[model samples]
Target: MKNKEKIGFMCAYTPLALIDAAGYAPYRILPSEACEDRAGHLLHDNLCPNIKKILDRALAGDVPDLAGVVFVNSCDAMRRLADAWQHVRKDDRIIWIDLPSSIDAMAHAYVQGQVEQMGRTLLSWSGSPMDPMAVEKSITSFNRICAHLSELAPAFASGAIPGGYAAMQALYNKASTRDFTTTLEEIEPMPGKTPAPKHDAVPVYLFGNVLPDPKAFDMFESCGAMIADADFCTGSRLFSPVTGGQKDVYSRLTSHLMTKPQCARSFDPALPGEIAKTTLSRARAVNAAGVIGHVIKFCDPYLERLPGIREHFKKNNMPLLILEGDCTLRSMGQQRTRIEAFIEMLM
Candidate 1:
């Protein structure tokens, strides 16, 4: 098979199945520490560090060879990042996805329409038409990937997986960049036995917008906590399966996007407390001793929802620690003392 042109995308809302159907590689543009200074100079300092890091990568010419890129208007920072990319990387084909914040009938319709439009745009860019069969094939393949990761969730929660950071890195890395078949082949052979905790580790549920540094997971482990599970866009949130029973491809795709465990930016008006409920449910499922909200600095969506998340934990008498960092190890390092304290308190 000839190497497919990579289409870089930012948010989870970007439909990878559609990208695959359009004959492009759906490479997630992850955040990194490489070009923060340059990004800060280009964009404002108060913007979300996740977006800044991505901008830095693009501006520094660190991103892989790409035919195009996609940015979802999930938040103000992301919108600004798309704007900055237009100015800095004008040569790259950039596509903006107007993601809906609410999960209602209207929102679903809007998302379905957007997905259809994105399909057409991707087809135009990649010289591939919208093939329903290709989309279905992609969906089936991705669903298998989701299944493999879902199978490992219990292992991670039970402390069976050694090196939480490495495990998470492998999980996110494969899901973001690799094809579904490759991802499945890589994970299917892993052992699933529950291992005893290396320490009497305090199990904690970690949720956030982005975790750029996997070493941050190491920091948590060093602080005497086990990341029982995570709700990061880069983590378990990617493991959601497309809901079954949809007769058509578009509806199936829309169902998958809308029903997955949502980020703070994607609201469910029907269940205003859904995000908090989902977090609490996951924490309870893993017998987590506490909850950690790790978000990038100036992430408007996560920031807006933090109060409700805090209240949910407080009402349940659960220890909740909110750590805001700038998508860099140095920023994460500064919070080590606090993280240790929180772990100690949990113990």
Candidate 2:
């Protein structure tokens, strides 16, 4: 244990937990919290909003004790962002891991290789291999966390929990890297805040990248839309359970991440439909009216697949409103009006 140096880690969903397990304080790039506007000037509008926001954060130098930054090529935007990071953080070691976009055995093996490579990079940078015992413990902890989150999502949907309030708490859990057991102990059910069975709002399933502003959520709720479920990598998709109970913790960790629905960069041929089904099922289970998809500008993967997803929803007669923006509150006013109108039509 070499004094537990704090490393600034940024990547798509699955890799965050791994870096944390490797004894680094894994930092997910939350561009909404950034101090400066580096991304607003350089990157074109076609680049992924999340990437742009992250680049802006990097430029602001808000990450004070960052040892290095990790980049996972989970999507094309990330690949280019890694190049940008290389240019900006010339002094920091940039570990770029190529992530596969499927859940098959070959995809698992591909991700496993990436995990092993990340381990070597960590050893070279920190002069330490992730402790085998710690890796195992982390796996168990992550599994528990995933299970608890799964429970939370449904409970939040069923009026057993207040969804907005629970989201606020979960965001804290993610930012602090709290282990599952500790988080569970801290999140006691709100005594009087338990949701009453109310049916005034139209249930909605939301999809897309991390919204930099909380106002986007407020906008949706203002339109009488209750976000019953979501498939965004930063949202519910990021918390799916990692398959555990394996002898090789390293391989299992990679495999678990590769299989989970949380990885947005994954391009499995079946995944788009799988996600559609899952989102629809959850929505139907909760009696949702439609879906409000926030399509981040320049996110090629989500953009490319949007047409097909829209078609699928149409087949099921599930109305979907696709809003394009960079997830900044300032840039999203027009989108808010459109959503408000869409919700009005739904009524």
Candidate 3:
């Protein structure tokens, strides 16, 4: 590694937080606002939106400055992203973490194994031992971060902080904690600021995309709809409780990885049916009146399974609105109009 080169990892929210605590600048790569001219020649047209978006930004030099890249294989698109990057540019050192699909026994074991492997890799790259002090500090810092995020639920549920902006802020803080500690500290407050306005606000449960722009959720709020709950990778999955105190950092990290809610591609043999059921069940649990299905544009797994999800929501007498997103940007105006109309009809 170059003396001035900053080491960084690119993963979803959970690992991003953990890596941040480990003293590495981790960036969450979004998929929209892509620079087609730069990356168009490298990847195919049929690639997933998240992959396309990241590649586009990399080609355009929009990504954060870092010495290395860590790509987590949370989904197929991400795996292919690593492949495409390696083929196009072999100079950057890339580490790919093979994340499992669900929270099961097998997955848990796999996660534990992966954590050990990651520890070894970090040791080689950073030339620092994965000692007890570093591990404890990382766990403590992450716990503090999770506490801060939990405090934002009320603001997120309310109109104060747009979900997209809040989500992006979470990423920004995780990526640049060394640069923005005060901002994170400021946002960490109790959420009981006069329970989210119930003024004709339709309660909607968001599912699918992990971190969307706050503007999209703000659009829902404009229509008097409140996001009562979200099964997002960023919102819910990041708060994995530590197991058996600090000594078992390994188990805590692995267990959290295994149990978090996953995308449609992560569903088992049920072919979208299970995911729809899981989503609706979660929606009902949160007392949400309806569901908002946000799928990344050109994400084949999610795109091919929307119909089944719609039918499942219909059976629950719950209105489902599908919004097409590209991670980096939220430009679904037509869908926004439809969502407003649906909320109007439902309310």
Candidate 4:
């Protein structure tokens, strides 16, 4: 596995299966805890922390030797990050795909064409012949990981999993960087009977733009909160099952990602309160006492929708705690007091 080169993808919307079929390991470049002083000079400090932290990795050379990177412009910050990436890391192998903001048949077709181009580019770089059958096989294996995550999410949320959401985050962290087949095999035996609940812990549902540090979950545990469920960019949203389709593989992949549970970057006009409604429903499913919304500072997509979501929760008679941070452990540390207070209130 180490023999193969790695190609990084920044957005969860980017299909890793396509990269996998092209004979490279798909590396999801999740935001990490890092000092962004280097990246700060290249990009605006007011931009989303996820972007800053990610660019810091490139500037610091903290990443593996990536053959190339597939950038999907899911939001404005991501677009800026991609531009900054080239400046910090002089790589001509960067492929930027402008993700369609709306979900529709036309939009899906456009993205399908884009990912089709992406797939072709990756194949050329890998020196692999374009084989539709191989792509299909690769996607099938990757889809298994998605389905597995769908199942794991509920168990972890319901406290049926031994380590709760922190354990689930550990699983997600591996799935982000490791090979899919190995991840599936490793997780196949992971589920067991429910462990005893955290004694007197407040079960809270957490939703946010990005929380890549799994230790954040551990922090919640220490603060007297049990993560009843979570919907973060780095959490359950990582590996959504490609919804079934009879269309071509790329089209199927496009449709699923375009329509899955997403961050506030995209939305359906028909469902104005989709995110809040979904969060409420999922939290209720786990019988959570409250919801914690941790948004990255300057993340406009999530921030713009915050007030509306808060109102939705208020109307639903659910307790909501809103927190903002820079996507770092220090931010998580600052949040400890607030988190502890919230848990105390819930208890």
| lDDT rank order | 4, 1, 2, 3
Once superposed on the true structure, which residue ranges of model 1 sit more than 4 Å away at CA?
156-159, 192-199, 270-274
Clashing pairs in 4: none
Rank order by TM-score, top first? Answer: 4, 1, 2, 3
Candidate 4 per-residue lDDT over residues 187-227, each given as its tens digit? 77766344544456788888987887877888887888877
Per-residue lDDT for 1-347 in model 3, tens only? 11223444444423443454445644455544646645546767666666777788777767656656777776666777788777755787776567766556777677778776776665567666667566666666656655566556655576555553345335433533231244345555434243554435777888876454555556666776777776665445545434444356677767655544566656665343787788889889878888887777777768888998888888879888888766643455557778888788778
Off by more than 4 A, model 3: 1-10, 32-37, 102-106, 160-184, 189-198, 234-247, 268-272, 328-330
Q: How accurate is candidate 3 locally (lDDT)?
A: 0.62
TM-score preference between candidates 2 and 3, better one: 2
Q: Tell me the tens digit of each residue's lDDT in model 1 across 1-347.
A: 23778888888877788887788778888887665468888789898888888888888888888888888878888888888988988898877677777777787788888778888889998777668899999888777777767667657645667656546556776678755555667777876545545547888888897884667777888888877778888877766777768778887888778888888888767888667778888899988999988988888878888898889989888899999988677888999999999999999
Better of 1 and 3 by lDDT: 1
Q: What's each prediction's TM-score?
A: 0.92, 0.84, 0.83, 0.93
Worst window of 10 by summed lDDT in candidate 1: 191-200
lDDT of 1: 0.79
For each of the candidates, the C-alpha root-mean-square deviation to the true structure, in angstroms, is: 2.1, 3.6, 3.9, 2.1
Question: lDDT per prediction?
Answer: 0.79, 0.66, 0.62, 0.81
